[model samples]
Target: MKRKLIAMLMAGVTAVTLTACGGSGETSTEGSAANAEGDKNYKIAVLMSHQTNAFTTAVSSGAKDKGTELGVTVDILDGKQDPNTQASQIETCIAQGYDAVLVEPISADAIVPAVKAANEAEMPVMTIVQQMKNQEDMAVSYCGGDESKAGKMQMEKAMEAIGGKGNIVVLYGPMGSDAQLSRKAGYDEVLKNYPDVKIAFEDTANWTTEEALSKMETWIQTGTQIDAVVAQNDSMALGALKACEDAGKDIPCFGLDAVDDALAAIKAGRLAGTVSQDAYGQGAIGVENMVKYLNGEEIEPFNYTECIWIDQSNVDEYIDK
Candidate 1:
């Protein structure tokens, strides 16, 4: 039913209201591309969901570096966690006649009209980080982590550490965002195998550390008996950890996205585990595929990168000695 509504929203109307502040939004990255004649033939617009966090910054940085290396004039835009802003940015890109547009959507359903508009204008559109909910056919390529598998790995590791029987709280991203939805599906998939294990509380903090901290603090104040915390992303997980730390409650916590702090947290024994989203890899590969498309080379519909479940045994592999 939700899928049907989303499809209709994408196909029928371009108007959308995007309200969630998913994370600490950051400014867009500008490419340093200047041609010999000071005239760039290829102009691309890379739109990011936000840049306030490590994961998004790595992706934006990778994309900007690669775009400059490829001699393509890239104009990166930060959507500031607003779908309306993203739609407007895409509309602006189309009007500016960019050679291609890449979007990391704030919300898949809301961003559909923008992607569809790019298709209608005959401009190539690529997606990074997350796949759009409906009208995915309009995209030329997608470069990101395998969302389905990300949650499975996190839950699997968490189950191992928790012995498959404990009450846990889940901190999630924006409800409709690809990561939030896919990660929850993975959680359910694993939870089905453990009858005694229960998700005591689940909520969305909009993928922000501050919000997650507030949620965790409130949960603590209520005296919620939680054995573990399963956060959909590192930022939220860190916030959860912070709350637990403040209350002097040491509990196993797991997160995805393996952001910089996540690695540090794992090394310091603040977190139980994390799964990598490979932000840099995805960004670089997305730009590579964009260049290939412009060079008349065909690319696959899905270019999924791999993720690793990081824990104490292998935390050293990620964190510097």
Candidate 2:
């Protein structure tokens, strides 16, 4: 009987050992699944001011395509040209625990705090197109066309087209944007080289066709003989064209941002020329940089792409039919 009891006890011990081993195997499988989920999934957020324009749209498209290539899921949020909305979007990104954020701030100053918060969260933030005011303190990198250079180049081309002497009108964009400031600086620098070219009047168009048209109409009412109009962007250029037509003025107009409409205007001989920043290139590069950062690689603080001059001479190659 004792021998029988000893055998039963041995069997019980064997059963307990088998149970423990099975439990350990199940735990290992669960742990592996959790790890796999973490590796396969990553989230990135892109905050844009407005997608209505070609420039910002190109930026968004580039980010989307690049994010996909790197196996990251991207979320694009539009601020609708509202600074408050943009700030809220950044906060939302942080609350949702996004792995990284890419922002194109609408207002340079308003977005500073939100960007700081993102930085505080240890989230890598990238700015494109428009930069924040305190950029050095907040963003990891900036990727976009050099706006000041764009402005300077546009002015130089305008002066060249007009034989280096003209009474020019300046149509500026949003009042407090870094792009506008840089572009204006460029304009000022280029104008220094051509003393004969005088700025007759400067007006703010706010980067809209209607606003520019209204502003130009007011200038026309003053009876200023505008030899050429320099708009900060293509939309404003189109507006200037309308105003010129309304006032019966046949003057050469220049614009930056080679949008489809701008290219069309150039073909129609309504606009003298424009500078193309290759928004697609900006988007592609921003994405490339973001991916590198994600993979623990160092990135440049500023990446400036080359700009192209688009005029009737070479508009066919750039403009879409």
Structural similarity to truth (TM-score) of each candidate: 0.87, 0.84
Clashes of each: 0, 0
Candidate lDDT scores, in order, read 0.78, 0.76
RMSD of 2: 17.4
Among all candidates shown, the one with the greatest TM-score: 1
Estimate the Cα RMSD of every predicted model relative to the unseen true structure: 9.6, 17.4
Candidate 1 residue lDDT tens string, 1-321? 001122221232122112212123323323344322345446777788877888887776666556655555556678878899889888887887888888888898999887888889999999889888763587898899888899988988888878889889999898899888888888899999999898888899988999999999999888878989999999999999999999999888888888878988888888888998778777767876887888777888899988788887888777644
Across 228-271, the per-residue lDDT of candidate 2 in tens digits comes to 99999988998998999988888788989888888888888888
- Total backbone clashes of candidate 1, pairs 3 or more residues apart or in separate chains: 0
